[model samples]
Target chain A: MAMSTASRVRRQLPTSPWLFAAPGLLIIGAFILYPFVSTLVNAFTDRRTLIPGRFVGLANFRELLQDDMFWVGLRNSTLYVVGVVPALVVLPLLLALLVQKNIPGITFFRSAFYTPVVASIVVVGLIWVWLLDERGLVNSLLETIGVGRVGFLSDQWLLLLSAMAVTVWKGLGYYMIIYLAALANVPRELHEAAAVDGAGAIRRFLTVTVPAVRSTMVLVGALSSVAAFKVFSEVYLMAGPSGGPAGEDTTLVMLVQRTGTGLTGRVGYASAISVVVFVVTVALMLLVLRADRRDES
Target chain B: MSVMEKVRPTASRPRTDAREPRVTDENGRRVRVGELVLRYLLLLAVLALTVGPFVWQLSTSLKGPTEDIFSSPPKFLPGDPTLHNYERVADTIPVWDYALNSLKVAAANVATNCVGSALAGYALARLRYRGRRAATLAFVLAMLVPVEGIIIAQFTTMRELGLNNTLIGVVLPGCVSALNVLLMRNAFLNLPYEIEEAAYVDGANVWQRFLRIAVPSVKGTLAVVAIFAFMGAWDDFLWPLIVLSDPSKFTLTIGLNYLHGTFANDERLVAAGTIIAVAPLIALFACLQRYFFRGVGEGAVKG
Candidate 1:
C-alpha cells in the first residue's frame, strides 16, 4: 500500500505541487523570512526610515550600550519577565485544578475565566487602565476602605508592576487552559494512590500532580517567559505611548517602536535593539528548557 | 456504612430524592457537600476576578453623563442606563469606520489563512515532492522569528512596496501565518493515507482529493485556524499601529488607542470604545468556546 501510494502520488503533474504551496511560501518568504534576514542585515547599517543606509558594522550595538533609553528598556523588559513568569506558571495551575472537576456549570466557569484571554490586549489594557485609575474602581474602592487613592499609573516602578499584574491577569486563562490539558493527562491511579497513602490535597499535588505536570510547568515557564520578554501592548496601553513617567516604563519592543518608526526613525538602531531582543528571547527559552533537562537528569 | 461502600458511590444505593441531583467528580465519586460548597466559593471568586472587569467596563459605558463614574465607592451598576456614551464615542471618532477596517482585516486574515495554509499543508503532507522538507523548514524558521523583532524591517518592506498605511499592508504580513500552515500540515499528516490512495486510484486529481476529501476531514482544525486568525488580527496593536499611519486606515485596536489617548479624561467614552471593540470577540468566543478550548489544548500539546 505504501509503495502503490507513493507511485500514485508521484504521477501528478510536477508543477501542481508548487502551485499548491505557492501562496503560503510566497507570503511567508516575503513578509516573515525575508524581513528576518533584513533585520539582521539592517542591524549593522545606519538606516533611517527614508534613507537607505550603508553598513556601519557594530556602531548600532555600541550606541545601544551608551543609550540610556535602551538600558531603561532592557531593565523594564527583564523586570517584566521576572515579575510575570512565576505568577503565570503557578497561578494557572491552581486555577486549572479549581476548574478541572466536572462540577455543574463548570464549563461556564471555565469559559468565563477565559474571557480575558479572548478580549484584545488593547481592551484588556484599557479596562485595567480605567480600573486602576485614581478615580476608577480600584482606587475608589481603596479610598472607601481607608487606604486612600494610590496612583497606579503615575509612579515608574508601580506602573511597571501594574503592567506586569495586567499581563498576569490577561494570561491567567490562557495558561490555565494549557495546564488543564496537562492535568487531564495525569494518571488517576497516582493521585488515588497518594490519597490512599494518607497524603492530603497539598501533599498529593506536590508529590503526584506536580511530578506528573512538571514538564508542562517548564513548558509554561518557557512560553510565558518568552512572551513576557516581548511585552509591549500591555505596557504600551497602560503606560501610554510615551511609556509612563519620563519613559521609565519603556520595554525593549516599545523602544523599538519609538525609535524605529516615523520619517526620521532610526531603523538601524531599532533593529539592533530587536537583535538584542531576539538573542535574549532565544536565551530565555534555552535557559528554561535546560533547567527542565537538568531536573530530569 | 461499610468502608468499601463509603468509598464507592456506585456500590451505595442511588438517592431517591430528585430535588438535589448528585454531584460527582469526573471519576463519578460523589463530592462531599462541604467540599462542593468550598469549590463553589473559589469558583465564584475566580469568576469575579476574571469576568468582573468587563462587567465594570460595560456598566461604565452604560452610565449616563450625569452619573458620577468616579464617585467614591465606585458604582457597580449605572443609576441611569443609557446608550449616550456609545453615541459620543462615535461622534468623537470615526469608530464605525475603524471597526469596519478591523472587520475587513480580520475577515481577510481568516480567508487567506484558511486557503493558503490548507493548500500549503496539503502539499507538504500529501505530495511527494523534492524540496518539500526545505519548504517545511522555511515555515518553521519563519514561525520562530518573532514579529516584534522584525517590525522595523517589515515596515521598510511595506514602505518599499508602498503598502504602508493601507489595510493590505496591515493584513499582508500575517495573512498566511507560518504557524497556521504548520498546524494545517500536522492536521493533513494525521489522516490515514489509504483514503487518499483510494481517491488517487479512482482518478481524482490531487486538487480534487484535497478539496473533496482532505479539507472536509480537517474542518475542525480549519475553524480553529480561522478563529485564531480573526482574533489575532482584530486584537493586534503594534503591527497595525506601525503599518498604518492614516487615521482612516486604523484598525479597531489602533483606534481604541487613539480614543484612549485623545479622550483619557472621560472614562465613560473610553469604556464605551472598549466595549465596542471587545463585545464581538466575547460573543464569538462564547458561541464557539468548545472549539476554542479544543484549539488551546491542541495548540499547547503540539507546542
Candidate 2:
C-alpha cells in the first residue's frame, strides 16, 4: 500500500486548489468585492431616492462637494482621527509596560482593562450617558470639588472629547496586549546592557523599550486611525442616530448610514459618501506604510 | 540599575520572588520599596479609570426604583439593592428570545468560519496551485476595506438573495473574516511539511491528510479564530439592525436598544438591560482571556 502511494505521488496529479478556496473566495466576492464595485457604480446612479433617477454623471460627487453636513462630518472625523491616534499609540504602551511584570494579580488588571472591549457599544454608551448626565456621577463629583456641571455629551467640543475618551478607554487594553507581546520579544539582554552602562530607569526605557516597539507603534497607530475613520457605534449610540445636537459628533460612517436609510433615502449619494471614506482610509494607510518603509530603509 | 529589577522573571519558576536580589545594588533595598509603591499606585489609578464605570453601572442596576441615581454627592453603592430592575426589564421585553437569536447568529458564524477559513487558509499556505497569488491578494485587499464602508451595498446584496430580515443575513458577510483566514494561514505555514509528506507517502490524499494531520496541528489558531468569530457575531448591532426589522427576529443588541427606547425615563431599567447585554461577553472573555490576548497580539505581529 505504501509503495502504491509512493508511486501515485511520483506522478504528482494536479488537484485544484480552487476547490479548497472556493467557499471563502465566493463569500468574499459576494459580500465585499462585489459590493465595493457596486458602491462605486451606484455612486453615479440615483436608484433609491426621488423617482428612481437615472445615471447622473458627477452629480452626487458635485452635491457631496457642496453639502455642509459632509464637510462637518469630514472635519469632525479628521479631528477625531488626530486626537485619538496618539493616545492609542502612547498610553497603551505605558499601560502595557506597567503590567508586563509577573506581579501577583496582574492578570486581573489586564482583564479589567480588557472588559470594556468585550462589551457592546450600546452598553458602553449607556454607562457613559449615565455617568456624564448633568446630575450624573462625574458632574456631581465635579460639583463637590466646586466645579460646575460640564456637558460631556451636549457641548460640541465636549461631546467630541467624550467620544474620543470612550474610544481610547475601550481600545487601550487591546493595543496594550499587542505591545505586551512585542515587549516579550524585546531582548532582555538589551535592558541588562543598558543597566550595566549605568542608564537610569527612564533613560533605559527611552533607549531600549521605545525603539524596540517602533513597528508596533506604527501598526497600532495605523489601526487606530482606521478605527477613528470607521467610528460609528459610539457616536450613533451616544448621540442618537442624528449624531447629537446639530450633528456635532457625526462621523463619516454616520453620514453614510443616515443618507442611505433615512426618510430621503439617497442610496447613490450614500455610496458617494462611503467612497470618499474608503479613499480617505486607504490614503491614511498608504501614508503609514510609506513612513514605515522609509524607517526600514 | 534598579530598573533591571523590572525585567521579566524567568519562566522556569512559578513565583517571581520579591526577595530575589537579581538587580540589587548598594541602595537597591530602599529604592525597591518606593518603586513597588509607585508601581501599584499607577496600576490602581488605571484600574479605577477602566473598571469604574462598570462598577457604577452594577450599583445603579441593583438600586431600587425610587432610589436617587443622580444625587448631590455621587452614590457608589445602591441604597436599597433589589432585583426589581431586572424583573422590570424582563417584563418589558422578550429578553430570552433576543439572547437566543444572538446565539444562533454567533453559532452559525463560528461554524462557517471554522470550516471555510480553515480550508482556505490551508490551501493558501500549503498548496501551490493556479490563482493562489490572486486569491491571496484578493483576501488582503478585502481586509483593508472596512465593512462599514461597503455596508449599503452589502445590505442590497443580502436583499437580493432574500436573506434580509433573517439571522443568516447578519451572519453571511462575516462568515469569512479575512483576519481569521490570515491567522490560520500563518499557523498552517508555521507547521512542518514533513508530516504532510509522510502522509502522502502512506497513501493519504489531500482531504485525508488535511483532516487527520494538518487540522490537529493548528488547534490553537482555530480556537482563537473561533473566539473572534463568536465575539464579532455576538456584539454585532448595525448589521442586524439594518437586516432584521421584526421584533421577534431582533438580536440582543437591537433588543437592548428597544429596551432603552421603551424605558427612556427609567435609568435603572436601562442600566439593568445594559448589564444583561454585557454580562455574557464579559464572562466569555474572562474564560478565554488567554486566547483573546494571544489572538490580538498574533494578528498585530503577523500583519
Candidate 3:
C-alpha cells in the first residue's frame, strides 16, 4: 500500500492541486484581498463613486483630524467597547455556570438562550426599537409600575446604551457556550478541594471558577470588543441611517457606510476612517493578548 | 447520601437514563434542592430575557388593529388574534419576493462555500504541491482582513465589473469566505492520513479520493460551513445594503429596514415584518441545534 501510494503521488498531475484551490483562491483574491489592497490605496486618493481620484497624499487623513462626525464616531465606537465588553466577558461566564449541569430540559434552555444569536441583527434591533418605544411594551410595563416612560430611543445616550444592551443580550449565549467549554475543562477536584476548605459558593467561584476561566474571559472580551467597535446594523436600525438625533449614535462603521456609498460618496475619506477602524481593532487584539500575558506572570 | 441515592438509580450503574429523573451535576453529584431551585430560577429569568422579545413580537403580530397593543400593563396575549398585519406587510412591500431573493443569495452562498472550501481545504491539507504554504498564508491573511473596512473598495470593484445593483453582486464577495476555507482545512487535517492511503493504493485519483473517501468523513464540518454560510448571507445587512441599489433586488434584511424606515409609526406592521424575517431562521436553528452547538464548540476550541 505504501509503495503504490508513493508511486501514485509521484504520478499526480502538478496542475491538479491548483485546480482544486482555484475557485477559492479566485474568489477571495478578487473579493477580499484585492479590495483590501485597494482600500489602502484609495485612502490616499480623493476617490468618489463617479470619479476616479488623483493622489491626495494625507489630505483625507488631515480632514479626518478636524471632522466633528469623525470625532463623534470615534467617541461612540470607543464607548461601545467600554460599555459592552465587561458585561459580555462576565455575564456569559455566569450564564455558562448556570446551565453547565446535566439537568433535565437543559438543552431546551440552552437553545432558547441562543435564539437571539440566531436571529438577524436587523430583527433584533427592530424588536428592541418597538419594545423601547414610548408606547411600547417596556414603557407600558414601566407605567404600570408607576414609573412614566423614559425615552430610550429619543435620548442619544440612552439610545447608545440600549443598543449596547441588545448587543450583550444577543451575545450572552454565544460566549456562554465558549465559557461552558472552558468550564468543562476545569477539574472537579478543585471545586471539591475549595469546598472542603470551607469556601462558600461565592468564595469558591471567585477563587476557583474565575481563575480557571480567565483566559476564556479574555477571549470573549477581545471578540466582543472588536465586534462592538464595528457595530453598525443595530445602531443603524434603532437610530435610523442618519444615526439618531444629531447623528450622535453614529459608530465608525456607520460613518464608513454613510460616507463611502452613493453617487457623491467621498470614498477617500471613508477609506481613511476604515483605516482607523482596522488600526483600532488590531490594537484591541494586541492589548487583550498583552493583558492576558501580563496576568499570567 | 439519601439525596444522592434518590437522584441516581443504583440499578443503572453506567448509563443514566435522561428520563429517569437524574438531576446530578456534571460531576455526577446530587445538587442540593435549594441550589437546584436557585439555578432553575436564574435560568428561567434569563430565558425570559432572551426569548421574551421574540414572543412579544409574535404576539404583537397576532394582535388585531382594534386591540390596543400599547396598553399599559401590556397585554401578553393578543386579544382576537389575527394575521391581518402579515397581509398588510406584504402589501406594504414585496416581502415574499425579498424573502425569495434572500433565499437565492443564501443558497448560492452555501453552495459556493461548501464546494469551494472543501476543494481548497483538500488541496491545503492532503495534496502536497508547490506554494502550499503561501496558499495557506493567503487564506489566513484573507480571513484576517475585516470585511467592514473594505466596503467602498468592494462596491467599486463590483461597479467596475458592472455587477452592482444585482443579486449576483450581493452573493459574490462573501460567497466563498476564507474563514470557512480554513475551517475545512482544519477538518481535513484532523482526518487520519491512512484513511485515504488505501484509496491511493487502489489508483484512485485525488478527486476520487476526495469525493468518495475524504468528503464523507468531513460532513460534520461541511454542514457547519454550509449552515454558517446560509446564516451569514441571510442575516447580512450592510453588504447587501451596500451592493444592491435596486429596491426590487433587496434582501429581506434591507427590505425590513426599508419597511421600518418608511412606516415607523405602525408598530404592528413592523413587528409582523420582523417575525416573518426571524421565524424561519429560529425554526431552522431549532431543528439543527445539535449541529449548531457542536459547531460552536468546535469553533471555540479551534479559534
After TM-score superposition, the amount by which residue B21's alpha carbon in candidate 2 deviates from its true location, in angstroms, is 11
lDDT of 1 by residue, A74-101 (tens): 9999999999999999999999999999
> 1 or 3, which is superior by TM-score?
1
Each model's C-alpha lDDT? 0.92, 0.85, 0.91
Pick the winner on lDDT between candidates 1 and 3: 1
Model 2 chain A worst lDDT window (10 residues): A7-16
Give lDDT for model 1. 0.92
Model 3 ranges off by over 4 Å: A1-11, B1-22, B301-303
Task: Provide the global lDDT of candidate 3 against the true structure.
Answer: 0.91
lDDT of 3 by residue, B141-255 (tens): 9988889999889999999999999999999999888888889999999999997887876678888999999999999999999998888899999999999888999999999
Ordering by DockQ: 1, 3, 2
DockQ of model 3 vs. true complex = 0.76
Q: Could you say which candidate leads in lDDT?
A: 1
**Estimated TM-score for each candidate:** 0.97, 0.92, 0.96
In model 1, state the lDDT of residue A199: 98
Better of 1 and 2 by DockQ: 1
TM-score, model 1 to reference: 0.97
